[model samples]
Target chain A: MQIEAISKANSPEIACVVLCCRIFIKTASAEELEQFVQAHEMDWDEVYKYAAFHRVRPILYKVLDNCKIPAPVLGRFRNYCRALSVFAFERQVESARIQQVLGQQGIVVRMYKGLDFTKLVYGGDIGMREFTDMDMMIDSRQLPELAKVMTAEGYECSQIEYLRRFPEHYVANKKDICFYKRSPMGKLFGFEFHHRPGNFLMDQSIGFRELLGQDYLHHSAPFSQEQYYRLMLLNHGASDYFPNLRSLVDMALLSQKGIGSVPEQLRRVERLSQELSMRLLDGPAAATPADNVVMRCATRITKLQLTVTLRSVWERRYMHIRFSASFSDTFRMAMKFLHYLMLPNELDINGVQLFSFKLYYLAKMVRCVNFPGRFKKVFSRV
Target chain B: MTQHDIVHRNEKQFMISNLGNEIVLMDIQQGHYINVNPVGSVIWNKLAVPIMVKDLIHSLVEEYGVSTAQCEDDTLKFLQKLQQHHMLNVQ
Candidate 1:
């Protein structure tokens, strides 16, 4: 029903676009959309929003047809379009500072996610979503040294504990490491260090070492401007651990440009889809006794939907509970919990798996209920 | 488990932060100080609006496996903290 009736529609391309729109609509308003379109040098029309909102399936299909966007790069295009507004204000300043840093350090750091993804994945002439933070990923090994250098240059590390305790663990085992600094403007900006080439979905073996060892693509010093641009989007999109459609769109846009290995990258991510799809359809065994009912009922939604739905549910379930200083801060924590829950599990893992997931979920629910503030006394003593 | 009597008179919004594990009152003006301790932050983030103190205590009891008596005591203490901080305004 969501599919458009275009005769030559690229199934993957169209689906990704539709997905991006859904996410974009959730956080953005009609006025914002217009402003974003104008900032991007695109024609801003009220009708476009209606088409995007009402019959997004067909409208996206038509846009793809007219643009002749490649099936693999649809994700990247959406990100580009969404970032237009913010880019106008921050692009030059941010990129110049990053470029200056890279040049001075003799290191090549690529921009990813927002506008960079648009340039790499989409048509290189798109807008992007209005997200507050900047995500950049550097070589995993270079992170510690880079962090030190940056600290010397006035970038104070926000997560001192993570830097102290998790650098080796993340470099040697886990995914990217998240580090941030409060900008002079008080905005929180993030940087991620990546040892691996692919994200969580891809086999960890495809790390920077392996990819460089195999000499997959041209790996040169002082990378070309195009390479720098594409690398940023690739890194940004990959680090989005959640099945956020906007992230997918960012990557898809890159694929269209024939930049990076979009097809191979997406194929690897398909594993996430296949695993979740199977779990939802076949009714994978419950991890906990209480979770059985929840899982069975949850199967009604697709496995991909599970992550986003659970995330939204968790947010609504715990909106009033103060986890930190602000609702925004608390929501961020809830999203983290949701991300943790999205971890893939082995099929034969038994009820222990179900139990843990449900346990966490229920625990979160319990926190929402405010049970006579029983835990407060214990908390006070500590 | 100690029952912390949480009163939400004139309550508007609430939030829980992860850094210090504190429950913050979002409704209060410039000097909003509905704060909690680490353990309190864990429970504070879970309090949905329109939540009852009893149901909250019951859920905590099941999840943490705490005794009913502890739940009652804890709840009361937490509520007192909220009142002290001017987080909860009695009708």
Candidate 2:
């Protein structure tokens, strides 16, 4: 019932959108479902668009059967659920295959966000969580083995030059080298092989690799349940300034179920997420009257075409990335930013051949030259 | 379509998943899905490559204990259903 007052049609706030999602993750009573639909049926399309943007419609679809979902909404929801189920299946198969191969070969690795994480967060249902990419954490020493095994499994190195071309960015990010395998339908999912944790901005040490290493790993070091929640919270709070509500819901769902006792650090992180943004219960309390318009404008990469403006950019940046800053963190980020600009290399172009050093260098040069213009635009907004 | 007409899968239209005892085929183009038994699963896999209907019948008769006439009838009906759903194209 309370969820009905959340996201309205045409313009939906981020807090309301997340609150609407909580109805499904936590499972609503029939009365609550009826009230929600009765209240928001007219403007449900806006909620649908919001859910689609966040890539969380499939999880919500499971609850449709218990409620008297409208025909049009049900059709759209079912179609999305089916499509997601197929992609999730593909991701699951590919991820499992990779893990199987690597494990057989005795390459100790940790699978981060993929089918396993979906199962951990949303139970063992195949399509409960949308999986666009599979993230794994392996030691830097295992890079050659990762490449070979991925190649054997028909995965092509998406960015082979980034490691050598921009050592500073590589060191700063301490992240994955994505490898891709295209499905029969031409859909591509990347196998992001992470080496370490922490970013230039966040000094948090809750990485799955570091958390469940050696004996606790069962020789594979798959992300333990609690560890995944911890990482999600850490990432949402610190490393990833623009934390998606879907991810927060994932943490909440796990926390609600009381799976894997929450550590003191994670409990602190959860409370921080509540304080930083609108929490699970806070509805539209923190949301502004124009937040929906601002959100619609901020979602530039999606179907919406909001005109870019200085204030809109500032608002979008403010909404998406709200980071806690210390002098040292800013100093380190500034250094990393400058170093990346000096020698840019993290470039992955669609249909472009990775082996072409000339083309790669050309793209890198273009980014480096235009970096100043982008940097100026950021400050211009504020 | 003639019985001798070549029959293979219009892979662009269909996505087949073998679920042990059941064969699930999704007509992605039409947004419809159908399931068949183990017998249909074998026939579907055999239809991966272009083959004459008679040849498919012969293979089915040899592998399955069903009579030639029954195999032909059932297979024809199954193929026709596939065609009706746009899961297959009969030339």
Best model number under DockQ: 2
* lDDT at residue B64 of model 2 (Cα atoms): 77
lDDT tens digits, residues A1-382, model 2? 2343333322333323454566665534546656655655345576577566666676555555456656787668766766666666566566766788998988766676666777666655656666577877777666766677777888887455555554444544556678887887789978887765555434445555444544533554446676766667656544443335566566566556545544453443454444323333332232223233233322432112111112344333343223223456456656655543443344433323355534655555554465657744533443
In model 2 chain B, where is the ten-residue run with the lowest total lDDT?
A: B14-23
CAPRI grade of model 1 = incorrect
**Model 1 per-residue lDDT tens digits across residues A114-177:** 4444333333322323344454546666766676666665655543334444455445434555
Quick one: best TM-score, which candidate?
2
Q: How many steric clashes does model 1 contain?
A: 71
For model 1, the stretches where C-alpha displacement exceeds 4 angstroms are: A1-84, A87-92, A102-108, A126-132, A152-156, A181-188, A197-202, A209-382, B1-91
Question: Which ranges of candidate 2 are over 4 A from the true structure?
Answer: A1-19, A104-106, A164-173, A204-206, A213-223, A259-268, A276-278, A281-322, A325-328, A340-343, A348-366, A370-382, B1-91
